[model samples]
Target: MSPAVSPPDARLPHRDARRDAVVDELRRLMARVEGVPKGREGALSFGLSALDQHLPQGGLAFGTVHEISTASEADLPAAFGFLLALLARTPGSAPLLLVLASKKLARCGLPHGAGLAALGLAPSRLTLVETENAAEALWATEEAVRARAPAAVASAIGGKLDLKASQRLHYAAREAGVPLLLLRPGETESVATAATRWRIGAAPGAQDRFGLLAGWRWHANLERCRNGEPRAWMLEFDHATHRFSLAAAVADPSLARGGEAPSLRRTG
Candidate 1:
């Protein structure tokens, strides 16, 4: 009998290498223009290998804008929890700026202090600013970003955030070497200037032997990435460490096509 031959590998190593080189060059140019340093210092790793490995800079890049939106009105709390988790991971004691528009406040209400502590965020570390409208919220966020005083700036503004406004915020963040975490309405049009955009939905969490709940869980869908692939994951935030980890690989039907709202089961 003739010897059986193995098929050649189908992966295109050369193509991937070329693409990575181009991305690196672009990062260098952007670093020069933005006056921000290049390399690992400029990114914030999620501490989850599955996620960090897929990011262009190995994590969420600073000196830029990252947008997050809820899957539905009910998911606003989960989205806010996710934001607090992100802020908790930031490497600084500097006061965090949270700008909110009155319209959004009336719709979603304010963040709770006890919830902040439960999410590994210190209430004293956050500075809250409530604006009368979306315009004022955006203005406050832009000025805060330019000031470079806060470790990060978060804005929960309700309205149509056009590309130009997003670009201005992006540039301000870049110049200040800080991050602008913008929370948009679920149905708002996506902004192009954001380095990455996420849509977060509430998800079922794990239970202990006695059927006790484990931690906060969310369905995170990476809708857009400037230099990476779009993906989704079931994430759990550890309140103790303020880090994210992969939840059990339970299939979520709501994460299916067309972006349907997830039917979240309350643990309490």
Candidate 2:
């Protein structure tokens, strides 16, 4: 009977099943890796361990657009300062182009040269462009990013950005291989194509070595990230160093003082 054909090699089916399982697992692993937003290769590091590790490519991705919005009018400076801090961390001497809507400028006033200098940004290195409205501001921003003349392009808009406009800016920034920073009002939150969305609010002010008021501190909420989890941290900007440092967590006032807690500022 030809030795019963060796029972059709029953173990062969089990071996084939195991091989298929291994192949399936490999495919799944590859899909997960590809799903991560790698940003641009050679991305700039934020220099803060807490923040950089959570960002795609282990840092802020160049050639992508990022959004920063304030929690209130009071938080505007913090948001602007945060953006400047990020720009300072970038590895280039190329000038930065700042586009502001006329309405926003009229309301928030112009950024002080001395304040920017304190943040390590030279006044001469900045070029300000005022536009009649948000639309024009966005257009100018796109042009600036497309030109790739500046190391970065930043725009301040007072209204919501539709998906179409956001997509246009995103594409332009990617094509030019430049970073784009968008500052929107606190209440203007809406869907957009930004690679990352940050909501910044004023945190407790930092104290000097003598325990006196020092530089500004901000609570940056990573509200949206393409391939990162949402996380929040208290960041202190050192004017002298032009670097951001993680702030120590604050203790609950009630727990520390055995009384009602001091009211904390609301942060979006």
Candidate 3:
């Protein structure tokens, strides 16, 4: 008798292949509908592969507002460092304006030219504006954005801003087609019309290429995004280059070679 024909294998891998194909097609369709501009006249890249993928328009929106806040007073420097790194990447020779509330300045101290230069910013290219309070600071930031004189506008507030105030700044930035960065202190979160919101704090120890203490590492959380999911990243700011880079997620402590972790140092 002829051998009975064996039944076709039931565990063939084609099932997975078919599922993957369907998923890929869905992603393509979603991207087409959601993808934002990427080149000049669009958004700015954060220079990190992980982050750009999650941001609306594939990067930070240019004609919109972004917010950054610290978890505590100690984290303020790291948050500010992250902002400075973004300013360093702004595309233009045009000076940028930094508006600060007088109360905020008294508490956080003024930004120094030398310190900014160390972070790859041209001190001369930064125009400082001081206001009496958060309300005035917000107004100045809006006006600066409307003026379009500076390449970007950044405002620092010592306290929280109401939703209406935040919306006004958002509209002004959009109207002028300039980016606006709002920096706030402490843990308070408010309803703001920002394209993205970030929470930043100091990370564990970080070492340079030579295994020596180099710069400060930060835990940056993408708290909110208009077109993407929230995510966290380990970001490092190199004093030598003043550029932000993705830090290794894990490292062997033994490789540090017995050097003590250095304190976070600021220039100026």
**Estimated TM-score for each candidate:** 0.81, 0.77, 0.76
Clashes of each: 0, 0, 0
RMSD of each: 6.7, 10.1, 9.0
| Tens-digit per-residue lDDT, 1-268, candidate 2 | 1233455677878866888688656644553454322434445677877678667546666777788888677788778888877776667788898887846436767788898888878888889998888888888999999997998888888777888998889888777778888888664665477778888898778887899876678877777777655656667877678787776553232332331212122211
Better of 2 and 3 by TM-score: 2
Q: What lDDT score belongs to each candidate, Candidate 1 first?
A: 0.77, 0.73, 0.72
Tens digit per residue, CA lDDT, model 1, 148-220: 7999888887788888998899778887878788888664688778888989899887676789776778988
lDDT, model 1, position 21: 88
Task: Check candidate 1 and list the clashing pairs.
Answer: none
Q: What digit string (tens of lDDT, one per residue) describes model 3 on residues 1-268?
A: 3433665577446755777688656654564444322332456678766667667555677777888888677888778877877887788799999887736335666787888888888888888888887778877888899998898888777676788888788777776778888887674775468878888888765776799878778877777776566656667778887766777652222332232222111100
Pick the lDDT winner: 1
- Give Cα distance to truth, residue 39, candidate 1, Å: 7.7
Residue pairs in steric clash, candidate 2? Answer: none
Model 2 stretches astray by more than 4 angstroms:
1-40, 250-268
* Comparing 1 and 2 on lDDT, the stronger one: 1
